[model samples]
Target: MTRRWPVVLVGPMGAGKTTVARLLADEWGVPARDTDHDVESLEGRSVADIFVDSGEAHFRELERQAVAAALADHEGVLALGGGAVLDESTRALLADHHVVFLRVGLSDAVKRVGLGSSRPLLLGNVRSRIKTLLDERSAIYESVATLVVDTDGRTPGDVAGEIGKALGERA
Candidate 1:
């Protein structure tokens, strides 16, 4: 059965996409799926493990495919890996979809993300790394988003409620 389209969430790491997506899934009366989780399960390894074992290029290829397939097949709330928006094709697919950007600042992301974690990209000088990433990808996220939700200093439920209100308005 074709369920309602997945409410796609995209943002920087630690921006609460996963948490907000779960909450939105409930509000939308549909399921939630994270493309990162899908990739992990498919490879039977953590994303960090994938990077360690296969390398960044390989992991990105896998992430690209997983995001592409999920965008095509998932009929629920879908949270993408932070870097997923880098792919032009994936960004193209997001057009006309209820794509919510969980926007968060570097300070907020630092607080939520913490230092020394599994995030492969934030491996060195967490602050500088995050800043660099934001510089690189922030514009892309804004460009692809249908609705932008600031996740700083907000509960997942609060963001979800805001999105629910937005979705209600859309309907």
Candidate 2:
């Protein structure tokens, strides 16, 4: 089925996709849906726990399904997991939507994410891992995005306002 969303947020970890989605939802008076949350809800566990128990491959499959379902059913602001674009089908689904790539510099991303074990991808050498993930995923994020918003040194409200303005222009 064909579907469209007011805004779909995509980026690497700590790019503020989730926070900005909620802010945008509030501004637009719509619900905010996150694929990561959906996956966690479905699995009844945290993302980190899913990674530990079922592995990245299993978690990715679940994420892909969650993204597909969210795209089909949700009409509100949607936020994707950092690695959701890794799936070809997910990228295809995003092509027809108003996708915003939340760009963040390496230092900002690391600072926002912190040296937390909660993130499976940044388990060791957090800075290096984030840098590598950002480097690897930047192009893919850009490819699927209809708009790009830099979140570096910006608040979630500011970013949401910018996105709201941009979406308004499109409307």
Candidate 3:
């Protein structure tokens, strides 16, 4: 059987989606695409800058477009921005693909991101913000995921390997 083209990774910020996507793409001999990076390339700025300049609604629209284009065009491991799944259309688009949700706990996420991170959403009280995001998005991530991988204490390589193994089993 032919393997799936894009193995999409979705999770909260600091869940290592981007890192694992690169590792998985390398292991699988394909390229890796990140929606956030796509947006940055198109806008000529960082995600934080986009959020600050145009506000979240504008950034989200750009993100939505980036995701749709990537889903349709790219054949690789794709990592989505943490809140991409919040858009219903994006979630619908993901229904047919292999979606992996990288699950990380509060403490782990805080440690991974650090308090001084430039992520727009985690502006103040980074720990509290992460917890809030996790609490709000966990169920949605699970609902859309074909596979859920706990990343609390795992390295990117290990997570990628597990995802590769799981996808292989599914195939």
Candidate 4:
């Protein structure tokens, strides 16, 4: 039988989805699955390396698979990759779950994620890419979000607590 989770966290690179998902899952006493980590585990390589080797198209396909498997096999807090929503299939899969859009402003995101690092997407023009991603993906995030939480100035604990409270209310 298939099982669904209570909350799925979706947002951009610096949105703290991975950390917050852990906090939420710890509070709920369940597992926290991050699709990027799952993909890394499955592929035996980092996402950046995968992109460098196989390219974004291949990475997206892998991400789709990882997201599908996690949604099917894991019954806990799940955090999707920032671009996971770019795939319509992934968006469709998220429609039935308790999806939380963890939003962060560009300045905060730049502060959190920085203009450097192994992030494949923002490798070139970090600021421009981040802005473009925010412009393009914001609506998709909003459309699929059952709840939206602005992560600006909030600690991960505070965000998790708010999510937990919202989950209680949702229940």
Best by TM-score: 3
Model 3, position 64, has a per-residue lDDT of 99
What is the model-wide C-alpha lDDT for candidate 1? 0.86
Score each candidate by Cα lDDT: 0.86, 0.91, 0.93, 0.90
Indicate whether candidate 1 or candidate 4 has the larger lDDT.
4
Off by over 4 Å in 3: 169-171
Q: Give the TM-score of candidate 3.
A: 0.97
Rank by lDDT (best first):
3, 2, 4, 1
Regions more than 4 Å wrong, model 2: 1-3, 169-171
Q: lDDT tens digits, residues 3-60, model 2?
A: 2574799999999999999988887778999999999999999999999999999999
Q: Cα RMSD (Å) per model?
A: 2.6, 2.5, 1.5, 2.7
Q: Give all TM-scores, in the order shown.
A: 0.93, 0.95, 0.97, 0.94
Deviation in angstroms for 30 in model 4? 0.4
Candidate 4 per-residue C-alpha lDDT over 1-171 given as tens digits, one digit per residue, 9 for 90 to 100? 122474799999899999999998888888898999999999999999999999999999999999998888788899999999989998898888989999999988888998775698888888888889999999999999998999999999999998888777322
Instruction: Choose 1 or 4, whichever is better by TM-score.
Output: 4
Best by lDDT: 3
Question: Which ten residues in a row are the worst by lDDT in model 4?
Answer: 1-10
Q: List the residue pairs that clash in candidate 1.
A: 6-76
lDDT for position 24 in model 2: 85
